[model samples]
Target: MTTQRTETTTLWRPTGPEELALVAASGWRAWPPRLPEQPIFYPVLNEDYAIRIARDWNVPASGVGYVTRFEVETEFLARYPVRRAGGETILELWVPAEELDEFNRHLVGEIQVVREYR
Candidate 1:
């Protein structure tokens, strides 16, 4: 008998350079810790959702935003199912702030910049 292995890959996030710095300063390997008042870290599932947030929310507040791509272990993603909100293909996953370190451990490689929003 052969067992099939699940190979899920690719996750994305959008943020301003300042925010990206937080991740970069940590060696471009993982997301940074959340602020005390912050409760969850959201990594969207699709480029569109990430782009929208980067363009709509991030740019307005920070004057610029970026869309980043990364990979995560499939099994880790299975732990958090995709979520949709208000009919958008949000493809969002909410990782509790406290669990971010564990989540980062699943990243397959360096985070990359796919595009920028301004």
Candidate 2:
């Protein structure tokens, strides 16, 4: 008998309360579609970056924030290049809004809330 292992890359997303609610409504299995004004869905490469956005940006804007962690097939992630938005630690995978449905299909498992800021 042979066993096969699936490789996955961990990603984190910083979300506000409203967005988190939609994710919950999906049963934590998928992210909601981006609004008309949201052109892209960027998931951070590291927890520190995600924490920074959730704590500093989301909290101030919405009074609450959450850091959600999830995994995606490593092979699928190779299609998108890692974008450095600022400093060395600021890395993200920018998934186009039009492709988000395909992105969600590549998720390895249910999204989980790893941290929260108020």
Candidate 2 structure lDDT: 0.96
Query: Which whole-number lDDT from 0 to 100 does residue 31 have in model 2?
Result: 89
Over 76-100, each residue of candidate 2 has an lDDT whose tens digit, in order, gives: 9999999999999999999999999
- Among all windows of 10 consecutive residues in model 2, the one with the lowest summed lDDT is 1-10
* lDDT per model vs. reference: 0.86, 0.96
Q: The CA-based lDDT of model 1 is what?
A: 0.86
Best by TM-score: 2
Q: Name the runs in model 2 displaced over 4 angstroms.
A: none
Every model's Cα RMSD, please? 3.0, 0.8
What is the C-alpha RMSD, rounded to one decimal, of candidate 2? 0.8
Supply every candidate's count of residue pairs whose N, Cα or C atoms clash at under 3 angstroms. 0, 0
